[model samples]
Target: MRGATAWSSPIDPMAAEFQVPVYFDYLATFSWALSGAIVALRKRCDIVGVFVLALLTSVGGSILRDGIFLQRTPPVLTDPVYLPLITLATLLIALLHQHIIHLQVVDKLVSTIDAIGTPAFAVVGMQLALDAGIPLPGVILVGAVSSVGGGVLRDVIVREIPFILQAGQFFALVVLLACIVFLVLTLALQVATVHAAWATIGLFFVVRTLTIRYNWQTRPLLRDEDH
Candidate 1:
């Protein structure tokens, strides 16, 4: 498939066709890495742990996508720019985390990054799946995995419950919805892929941010007798 091989090298951000999506993927990687690094610091992990989480959180989804679905070399290993970019993000968080931790906006910043990165990765994964001729259901699954697989892995590594499994807040649900919308726009309505991707990313980011701002949450199936 076209996307299966596109990650071997950095593409020109200004190039037409796949430009915006590719660039968005890079930005999403850095955002995820930064978020992971911050979590590592908060968990009192050493530098190695910080780097490990940062790198994994940035590319774990892609790895899962390629390994399990595409059966290709994961971009995290082949793409020259991915590792260095993740390293830069990790370094920034590792060095400035102490100062940033005291800031009132830190939580907001993390939410903002996650909000942006989630849809960015999701749409990109959807596009790749389409290019690979994957069926609609499989495309949606790939997009969802590309969106939240990293966070799930990160939480597992830290011995915490995965955010998607937690009752509070919409996480993977947002990604699933975004993927569905993108597919509807591009497939059903026949919209251009790039335009649909951007629209999905913007809409997802806004909706995700609002969920965080309003503290929107899901309830578990069973009621707590004590409560």
Candidate 2:
């Protein structure tokens, strides 16, 4: 991707693109927090644990992203959107827990939400890193790590290997692909940032869908116990 320098142009395409892919960041947080709450509740965790887990899962990524960028304290903390959303999703899961279990639709919802959430992260992470003037490789690494950072932390705290490492899914690949997408479009095509964001979101999700559909995963050779 063409690097956005001080003299690149008065217009900033990357800023525009940031807005487009950002919605997915919101959705991913909501779903991740909700999912954690559901799991915690299912395991009979206490009320405080439920809330803590929910917040960590949902807003964790953004907090890390914003901090790295030296942006304002995250809106997820001050804004009203996340708290209520987490609360509602958690309560609903708690109330409907029994009925939802063993329901194929629920399983599908979980899987779809998880699959969709992954790529949404890739765009957000890559964009943030690029905006911060990080190198592409660093941006890619940061993107992948930020994209799934919260989930990985949540799973570890709750005692589960994150989906990225298992489940035959190309979790990190999604973020890396997203980083490449942004770099290529911004640098090579010099496409406006917002348009690039739309493309990134579309492509990332499509790739993630294929990865899930085909059970695409890192090679088993990478899974040795000693590694």
Candidate 3:
């Protein structure tokens, strides 16, 4: 409980009851929206398409995880803040598309943002599943889904394969590992705190960065033609 006080209280209780986790959610949403917008611009999508993709990438995972999987209304549908945040992200991307597209650092920026968001969303999903009293496997599933489902949806919309199913990157695996680590710390060790969540996010970011740097990949099964 040492670091708990630093994260508990909202500055404006009347205006919004935003907590630390909600802040994480907002960060993840913004990062994913930016990535989606970049992809839309890369694909030569119209402004409408860019906005749609940004919205989908920002809130799509939460919708699938909470609404479809958990059988409840998603926060994006109910929360007033989320829509405005995504709208702002979309408009920023629209205005800066020309500059962003020409930048050599765009890929790195997207990858870094995605790396940061994935673990945050994964921890959020695990926390929700734990609060719902879901089983261990269910918690892990929801966590992974919450981390990558939006990116998958965005890629599918643009006719590209989901990054999780692709050959190179251990992106989804990092999310799963982060979920397991978080649950182990909170449930098994009984150390549930905001610090634990932050630790999980840090671990995930380190692992993901190493994976990308080393070009680590999941091994594929042998093809039929090999026989």
Best by TM-score: 1
Give the per-residue Cα lDDT of candidate 1 at 31: 85
Write the residue-wise lDDT of candidate 3 on 1-227 in tens digits: 12223233421221211223577678789888888888888889898888899989988998998788866568898779888898888899899887888886977887887788888888777666655656789889998998889989998989887877876767777787788888788777877457778888899889989998998988656666887
Ranking by lDDT: 1, 3, 2
For each candidate, the alpha-carbon lDDT, in order, equals 0.81, 0.69, 0.78
Regions of candidate 2 where Cα sits further than 4 Å from its true position: 1-18, 21-24, 68-72, 222-227
What value of lDDT does candidate 2 attain over all alpha carbons? 0.69
User: What are the per-model C-alpha RMSD values against the true structure?
Assistant: 3.9, 4.3, 5.5
Q: What's model 3's TM-score? A: 0.88
- Cα lDDT for residue 46, candidate 3: 91
User: Per-residue lDDT of 107-206 in model 1, one digit per residue for the tens?
Assistant: 6776787788888888777776766667789989998998888989999999998988878887778888899999899889988778888899899988
Off by over 4 Å in 3: 1-20, 223-227
Candidate 3: the clashing residue pairs are: none
Every model's TM-score: 0.89, 0.79, 0.88
Error of 2 at 126 (Å): 2.5
Model 3 CA lDDT for position 50: 88
Assess candidate 3 and give its lDDT. Answer: 0.78
TM-score of 1: 0.89
Ranking by TM-score: 1, 3, 2
Q: Which 10 consecutive residues of model 2 have the lowest summed lDDT? A: 2-11
